[model samples]
Target: MSAEPPVSLRELRARAEEVVTPEAWEYLETGAGAEVSLGEAESAWQRWRFRPYVLRDVAQISTSCRLLGHDLATPVLVAPTAYHEPYHPTAELGTAEGVRDAGSLLCLSTRSSRTVERVAEYAGPWWLQVYVMTDRDITEAMVDRAVAAGASALVLTGDTPYVSRRARGTALPLQDEVALVNVQQHLAGRTWSSLEQDPRVTYADIEWLASRSGLPVLVKGVLRADEARACVAAGAAGVVVSNHGARQLDRVVPTALALPEVARAVADQVPVLVDGGIRSGHDVATALALGADAVLVGRPTMHALATGGAPGVTAMLRALTAQLAEAMGLLGISSLGGFDRSLVEDVTHARG
Candidate 1:
């Protein structure tokens, strides 16, 4: 018989660290400043306890859900991360294929090593992540190109107006040929620093982008209830409670802790998704119970891509989904519709 593959994310990350260069590994692992936000994002999930129901008909657990009109086989999506080429030769295409195989969604970053069109060719349900450029024309053109290339929605990343300082120091510079394929022609001869996004971008831009592309807009990086509501009012189809995986801001409120307020502010008017330090199925369940309609995973997906290309990503996603289903079964919840605030208790307060 064939040997079993690694089903644990932690195991995959360890194996990936062994294969990738020190620079790449550091870039993937390090967060901004003291890394307190990064650590908190994962640990905060543990502060909540599941209050499982008994004697309910959870014989067949279904992990299906819908996000912005798209049906997802699972509530998880591969969150947009930059420069996949550092992880594997196939880069975003390999990641796309893995997400497709897992029957999940993918959010492709504008900084991807491959063009949006190329990645779209391999993906299933996909969204295009955009960092509004200092150059308005360039930003508009990118949005158009992604929509033309079959992106299902536009995920406007709002938290990274300026790059953060990483506590673990910088990675080695990317090679000249390691271009942002989607916008390389427009950026020829310019340093990556020249691509710095507009720090002053506002809600007006979100409205303009929605009008320009006519695609559903999801404003990522919102932590406050007011900000979440503002995004929706400004034409956001969804709001993602994120702190750029706690990479853009240090000591920010963890996304897990921030999700409840944002979710309540949006109040079902628009889907609320989150991404931070989610690493397991229990994390996924915790997000849902706190009011996240779906969750996006970044580091874990990158770790999987680094280890085994498309197959590793598929295995990682499958493992997460399986764990989620098992958790639902144990909680006596048969479907996502059954998830409610009552299912979770904030043990952090109770402990005090």
Candidate 2:
């Protein structure tokens, strides 16, 4: 095996595939119902062409920004992903350490192999991603525990009320050893299916969570402009435009395609973040130009973790940051705030 970490996200994924078991690889790589949305998500960024300006000072490019009162070194954050143990033995703890080293934020999943308290031990701003379970008390307890464990924000995944079918089939079996430590007590004696997200969860639940927790609540999985406004009205501190990596509904609009609409609807009332098919710094630039405040990265982080553990993740983040900076410099923009809709244009419908 090569000692060096892969330079490109695509190469990193290929490396991960070589190292991990087929079952684990399938679980990470596959999306729901033929995955049309999955392919569209990454491809959507290409539809917008960048309009660069010359003869301007581009020195001192920076990717830093403040998100929900927290300073981020880069606009990139690790989107919540489940069961890291399938990729690396150190699991979420190692992922946390890696993100800390990258000077970015990490939104940990409720399905993490390590408990929130354990992952919180690492140095970084962290958020807890939650799924409101069938049991309301369990959901409340999770929010309280995550706050107590030092999470700065609560990202309520508004998608996945129920699991969707993956054409590749579910490969990773739920084993007792890798228990979801945060809610294991509440899960005791209950069938695993009981933990399936409460399909009935609604905007009222967002209100309830905001009332119960002091942390800012961000609703993820919003695709429409009207729904984005509804979440803010329901007390969401922010909204993440996502389709659960196209793992929930396969034909839903790509996050890149949906971001501008949601961002426009929210009208800066709350920060708009986006995830799904963000694989490069160019993609990050496109998202910002289209009105996203920041972008959340998922599978790339997992690929880095699988290839080289914490160090791999750190390198991947740094590489992405560098790529973003280079793109900014070439565009003659010195900061993220310089980005505007005028900087990007849809070329897909251009007539010659």
Candidate 3:
């Protein structure tokens, strides 16, 4: 646990550094190739300075938000991540508990150490994030399992259609501890010779998974405006414009830059959310004001958890939630509906 009192996410991140492996730390911290985009994501967040308006009655404040029919205490959802056990033995379950207790949503990853069914046993207003495999059977089966396990939402990641080529720290060895349970049965007869055939995404993958899931399915990893339109037309309830946190492709536009176009393209056809370098509650406010219905967060939470475990994650959320409320109160936003395009003025020559 962190000896220092955590007043905000920054404190949680500093504490997380003490417990995380150097290799895993780099894995979470690094961006694609030369890491220019990674820096840009940070720069993007920093560039968007807030215009605060004081002298309002903020006696009553609410951070409540709804995604796919589930109301969140805060719009902050736990972005999908794999193998929490590496950071804490309780792994994704601990993450679920944190999200549940925090009154936010936990989106369990397809690659999670805990099976979807097992993770579902924890209290949730949760979503299951799935990787669409080339094999229709596997995709269909994963959807079936997620549905049976009582998952309320399905997030299909479209960004990571292939393995990432970026350079990062050494991959933490999860072979001995973490196993992918949902696809394990289908992988039994799969051989190295057939490995090329095992990618978890295909046209049939989308069509098949949607056929089985009665819940809302969100397509993640979208960047281009045309692709955003396609995802909605293909029946996505929402789109999460992301470049896999700059982990997949280097030099891609920062997640925030790509969001406005995609959000415009979708045009209420579906809600749009984005993720890449979001770090704070003001970042969340800025994202909403620009166009996103919500935003996703990844590495920061892990950074916090790696530093402080449950308390670290708890403190991080508490600070972000408080900061978000403060941002809103300062912005004179009595509710989310009040945030609009006029609220955000794009800074020229500023990092996007």
What is the RMSD, in Å, between candidate 1 and the native fold over all Cα? 2.5
| Ranking according to lDDT, highest score first | 2, 1, 3
Query: What lDDT tens digits, residue by residue, belong to model 3 across residues 1-28?
Result: 1123325555666777778777667666
- Weakest 10 consecutive residues of candidate 1 by summed lDDT: 1-10
In order, candidate lDDTs are: 0.86, 0.87, 0.74
Tell me the tens digit of each residue's lDDT in model 2 across 193-249. Answer: 667799998998887887788888999999999999999999999999999988878
Return whichever of 1 and 3 wins on lDDT.
Answer: 1
Report backbone clashes per prediction: 0, 0, 5
TM-score each candidate: 0.95, 0.96, 0.90
> Candidate 2, 314: how far from true, in Å?
0.9
Q: Kindly provide the TM-score of model 2 when superposed on the true structure, using C-alpha atoms.
A: 0.96
Say which prediction, candidate 2 or candidate 3, comes out ahead on lDDT.
Answer: 2
The TM-score measured for candidate 1 stands at: 0.95
lDDT of 1 by residue, 1-352 (tens): 1123327777878999999888888988898899988888788888899999999998777888977788888898899998889888999999999999988999999888888889989999899998998777778888999999998899998988898889995664577467556787777566665577989889988888889999999998999999998998888999998888778779899888899999889958999999987888898998998999899999999999988899888888888888888888888899998888988889976644
